[model samples]
Target chain A: MKRLDIIRRAGRNLKQAKVRTLLTALAISVGAFTLTLSLAIGAGTREYFAKFLETNVNPQSLFVVADKKLVGFEGGNTGPKEYDPGAANISGSSYKTLGQSDLDKIAANKNISSVQPNYNLEATYFTYQGNSKKFTGQVGMYDKTIRGEAAAGSLPKLGTMIGADDIVVPESYLKALGIKNAKDAIGKTITVHVVQQAQTKTTEELQALYAQGGLDALTAATQGKSQDVSFKISAVAAKPATALSDNVQLNISDTRAQELADFTTQGTSQHKRYIAAIAMVKDGVKPETVKAELEKTGLTVKTARDLQGILFTVVNVVQGIVAGFGILALLASIFGIINTQYISVLERTGQIGLMKALGMSNRAIGRLFRYEAAWIGFLGAILGALGGIGLGTLLNPWISRKMSLGAGSHLLIFQPLPICLLILALVLVAIVAGWFPSRKAARLDPIEALRTE
Target chain B: MIELKGVTKTYGKGGNTFTALDNINLTIPDAAVVAVVGKSGSGKSTLMHIMSGLDRPSEGSVTVSGRNLHDLKKKELDQFRAREISFIFQSFFVQGGDSCYDNVSLPLEIAGVPRSKRQQRVEKALESVELTDKTRQKAKNLSGGQKQRLAIARAIAGQPRILFADEPTGNLDSATGAVVEKLLFDYARANKATLVVVTHDQDLAAKCDIQIHVKDGRITEVKQ
Candidate 1:
């Protein structure tokens, strides 16, 4: 018989057994729907989660903690221990020094694109005023490591440094010190007290006393007793609110003073210590490669995924298990097709006999049955796939509304290859399921079939 | 012309082998009505199956129009059947749930007859059997006699050279069976095609131009 005739006949037969056929098709469709939805959802989740992480954290930056050997400390400095004054928090280097030499070696590393070394400093001084005040303050110095452009004014140049020694005071300081306009403070000189240990001689005290005269009369009066030293201010810099450095009340006057300052804090003071470096890799270089290089320096480097920790692993495992269950549902639907085809054969026995009597060869009979089964499977799969996509789209809003974290599910794009593969799989199952019944129908003896009531 | 030369069809193997057509040799001339009469399991239906090219003979060849039916491949035999052979069954072998017209149009459709022209041929064939008025009626709703006429209309719709009827009137009452038998012989006579009928009714067999008596898979008598 012609294929069109066979198809028409098969369609009529299905219509005859409408309830059963519909039920079977429904089972197959449900299986396909769940399978498709699971795969799409899993894919979208991965893409969305990865995108979220990328947005929240820097994609091309490496985090650097202090290398103990690089710290030049004899004892290993490891783990996070809070700085408690009662606890002997002795610094192997009195000065928090990751001096210029260490910065040079880091810059020379092959993958190192640009380096931003950070240090904090605190100092104390006597004021001209009778009352002495201690400056337990902090400072951070970075070289062009700021994340974005300053909202106002020209940015400081690459060589321009912000340190406790070169204080770019925050706007809060303007309010606290009763300074007028920020521009007026620029180029103005002020005396800051610098305190020293008892071992320092009278020459240092006299020098500090002379510098206090530069301070405002009130500040000068308080320096001799409470403030230890005074210094000349060169420039007052503009500062944004998130600035990382403390006020620079005093800076080294000459190379001799700097050397003396470095030596004084070398063995005992943990204050003014620098422990971390944050660097940016060049645009083309991968952040991962920089991280690997940093690890070799005995410093633990971290990436976004590392920081995300157990959450990333858990997401992947959950998706896998859910997909596995969906696969099981798909398999059961295939078996459901087999059962439906078998039942269909039993119901169509008389029809088979009639076709055979009409001079339909065994081959024609086989083709008819096979085509019937295949049509059922193909239609079921198509409807199921469409339903799956529709359901996924519908559920997207509900999921997103229920949990804001589920936002970004647009990552669940339907992949063409998987959909095609699913259709092909259904076709295969249909053909296989039809095989036995088709053969049985074809093998029917004409005389025996005619004899059937 | 149809000729069965020493045709033998055996079933099963080992000790269970039973010959359904035991060395049955017969010749049916063109444009003649022939009836094969036998009891149940007498191998009359087997004879029709082999003659219609729906089956293969195990030990012999069936020749029609000088071509060996046994020699044709499965697909070639199917085309041969669609083009030259047709069938009528006693229990009305119309596809159920379809209109009588669709059942009659089925063979023509399978033969790839053009739809624009198929209706005319189907109408003429149905009219030959006096079923033109019932064309839109479902086969399931037709009386036994009407369904048998519909089956006969379906069998002859493609204008085949030969028609095989397996107890074509067996399910009808005597009056209805007579009507169906008359229709079959009349159509075959008008078309000048060979007609082969298998029936247990002696009266039905008597109406044919020739008769073959099959007893226990063997033809015991052939009367002309």
Candidate 2:
């Protein structure tokens, strides 16, 4: 018999037994649905992580910090360290901050184009109109490379001078100031009062005092002597300005930042030292190579790509496990296919005998049964894929909203290649499942089959 | 011509062994209507099965149109049966789920007749059996004689060289049986195909041009 004829006969047979065919197809559909959904979730999560990394990290820049082990005895120390009055006490250990000489040494590398030092600003109160709010501030040289997205306005342009009159606030700062929109706070001038004390104190000592008596006692201890400086709000970012809790950041020109450091510690022997620096690698230079060069100077370097890789690995593992379960479901469905075909063969014994006596080849008879299985697989896969995509699309908007992942984001994403492969795989599995039953039908003795009631 | 020489068929093995056909020898000329009359268990049906290549003989060779049935491979034997022979059973063996047209079209399809020609041939075959008006009706809904007529249409639709009917009118009333018997004889004469009928009815057996009688799994007599 021709292949088309066999297929037609198989389809007719399946139609004759509609309920059995439908139930068997449903079993296969369960597996296909789960597998497709898992793949979609994996793709969506990885895409989201990639976007986060792109928006928050600069590919060409490396974060350079003092050796973490040598920075603090809390990390574990081999011996007692010499005491330096100018050293910043961080986490119960006094560590030398990055000085001019250290910056010069890092800047001498051939691949390093520029280095911007981060400044530690003292606690101060900012008054806008009649409302005064105390906030801890950190001063940094304004550069276009700093990683943060603006809710309104834009970051300070590269090579543009940011003097004492310029500052960048956080989203929380705007909320605290009763501003409903980020764009409304742009170009507003606020007065920042820097409290200058008569005596210089270690960072740890200052923190202890602030914890004990709040900012009011520290203000009184400074004899109320403070200098007021005015700065214009340049931009508002979504993330907080500094790692410090509740603290906002002020961006100023390097010259102005140096001037503030000198004025804040002028009464004592302490001098200006930077907490950390960001090294900008030139175009076409590998950041890893530059990181290796920087590590030789006793500095720790990290790149955004490394962090993104770790996140992607985690997503892949999760996807693998979910897909594994889907495969198990498909495996179970394979047995269902086998059982259905066997029953069909038994029910059609007399019909099969008639066909054989009509001179249909055993091979043709086998192919007819296999074609029936293929049809079941095809229907199941289509139903499963459509159901998975439908559910994903239905849940995407609510999930995005709940997770605060901006509009147009989907938590479940379907990629075409893998889904097509999944359908093909199901068909192949169905064919395999039909093999034994088809063989049994083919080898049946026509005389005996006809003799069966 | 079709010939069966020393053909014997056995079932099972060891103590369960049973011989269904014992050294059967027979010959029927082309275009002749022949009947093999026997009681149940007399192996007349087994003789038809072996002649049609539906069953293999344990001993001897059967040949049709000068081709040895035993020498052909499984696929070739099937092809030979499809192209040169057709069958109608006592039970009709119509696919009840299908339309009368589909029931008649099965043999042609199995013979690999191109789709373009199958409809015309199937229509002509059904018309010869006077079932064209009921072509669209499911086989299960047809009367006993109509079902047998549909089976006859299916067997002759492929225009094979040989036709085998095992008690073709056994389930029908006399009036309906007469109509089916006349249709079968007329179709065989028009196609010049050898017709072999197996039956216990003396009236139907006497109508054929030749008759063979069987008893105890062996042919007892032949009359021409």
Candidate 3:
């Protein structure tokens, strides 16, 4: 039969059982809507969160320790002798630190991309207007500074001996400390107390002290208990600030904050107090490939993704559940379509028989039923998609408010690509749901159907 | 031509077995009008169904236009029925929800006739049934006589070699049924199609070229 003729006939048949068809269409649409909305929202949230984290830090930074035999005991009095914590080196002694020469080599490689030097000092504090503000700060102490900069003060001149006096603080710290202006904090003296672990005290006490007063106080306590070096104030320096999370302002300089042994403090001996020299590539560069290259150099490179495995996992789980709901909805909708079509079939038994008596092939009859169902599903999907997007838009503000996710000023982020994908998914569900019943109707025994009184 | 040989149709299994048709043999030739007269449970409808390939007999075989009905798959059987036969019911089973034109055009449409051809054919059929003016009207709007004529028009439109009419006048009053009967004969004569009407009405059976009496799933006699 001409497709047009079949369509016309199908349309007539559908009208004969209008209520049933509509109900089925509604059910299918609900299912499709659920599936689409869940997957889309979940995926979108992941993308947004990942980007937020990536923009703030080096996604491919790695830390490599020079420990060849490191191990730890679960209890203080161990059943087995504990090896040095950083002694298990991923690479041998032939492995070198990612110094200037290594960075120069990395820069030459096309895949290596941009590499920035990293130095983090923990025993840092800034003193503004004679009041000392203690905070944990990473001292990049870069031959070239990457991102850490005072919201107000100029970067210290290179090789100008940034010592126990020069420091910069993060904008957030300035805000938290009730310093509305960054200018009030410049030319300030800060103290950085580098605390090396002592043979005289246990690691637990040192950790407790570090956690209580940060690196500066921990270093001072360690020094008081063993080494006799008075902690002094240093110049103030700023830390990186972002809208995503909270950060503390730190005091940092180019030189050692304290006259502590480099190996004892910056080495395996000081397990709790560690500083990693992380090199960050630009945002667009592929972190994974560069990470592999860094791995080859015996430096343990990791993506921000690897470091935030827990966060990523949690987000994924949430998204998965939401998507599962969406899938369930789509499935429910599909069953709804099937149910509606089945009712239609029951109502149109006589009509189907009449068509067969008039010389319709089973295939033709099947096609008619299928066409009717498909039309219903297609309509439902289109409508459901519109409904879902509208719902997403409507719920955006409420969702953001509840989630506390700062999705900019717009309430609904109508991501066209995600929405399009959702629509496609819903349509597929609608179509699949219509399949079985349409076939069943098509395969009905002509005589039995005709005899359906 | 349609032929049935040793056809037996049994329902259920073992002790519950009941034969709807028992070793029935019959032949219906092209351009001939034949009628089967029987009571409600006399196997007339069963015979009609088997002849139309709507059901396969438990035993024996049926052939129409040299093709065995039992051998065709369900889909193939449907195709065969669409291409080779048209069936009319006593109730004048036009789809009530659709316009008369849509009802009459259904068979042609199902056969995948182009829309233009379907419209032309439907118009012609409606004209033949003298319901051309009512083509756009829903089947439910037509009178009883008009509905019967619409059914007749639909049956004839497909140009099938064999036309099976099951109590084509069963639901109509005598006067209306007479008119419908005349239209059936006229349709058969005009198209040179074989007509097989299964009915219990003696008057209707007498009008055909040949008449067969059915009793208890068996044929008792044939008259011509």
RMSD of each: 12.3, 8.2, 7.9
Instruction: Judge candidate 2 at residue A382 and give its lDDT.
Output: 83
B30-145 in candidate 3: lDDT tens per residue? Answer: 88999999999999999998888877899999999999877788667767877778888976778888888877877776666776677788888888878989988999988888
Least accurate 10 contiguous residues by lDDT in model 2 chain A: A239-248
lDDT (0 to 1) per candidate: 0.68, 0.82, 0.67
lDDT for each residue of candidate 1 in A1-453, tens digit (9 for 90 to 100): 677778877777777777877777777777677767766866666666666555444566665655443322244555556554322233532213344555566677777776654433335532222224333433223333333222222335532443333323333344435456665544443344334333323665556756765545334434333233333333444332222233333332333234334433443343333455666677778877877887786565655556444344555677667667766766776677677777766666766776665567787788777777777777778888898888778777776555444444463557778887887787677778778887887887765676666
Top candidate (lDDT): 2
In angstroms, the error of model 1 at A204 is 38
Q: TM-score (chain B) for model 2?
A: 0.96
Per-residue CA lDDT of model 2 for B20-136, tens digit only, reads 888988888989999999998899988888888888899999988888889999999998888888888888888888999988888888999999999999999999888989989
DockQ of each: 0.28, 0.60, 0.59
Write down the TM-score of every candidate: 0.66, 0.74, 0.73
State the lDDT of candidate 3 residue by residue for A287-356, as single tens digits. 7877677667655555666656645666668767866776776666666777777877887787777776
lDDT of 2 by residue, A1-453 (tens): 888988898888788888988889989998999999998989998888887667655688876767565422245544667887667676665666777787898899999888877666664666654455564545555555645556776765443444556777777777667778889888887666676667656788778889999998676665645677777887776652221133255555566566666666556434557667777888899999998988888877766676577677778888889889888989999999999999989988988999998889999989989989988897788888889988988989888776667776677999999999999988888988999899999999999888765
Q: How far is candidate 1 from the true structure (C-alpha RMSD, Å)?
A: 12.3
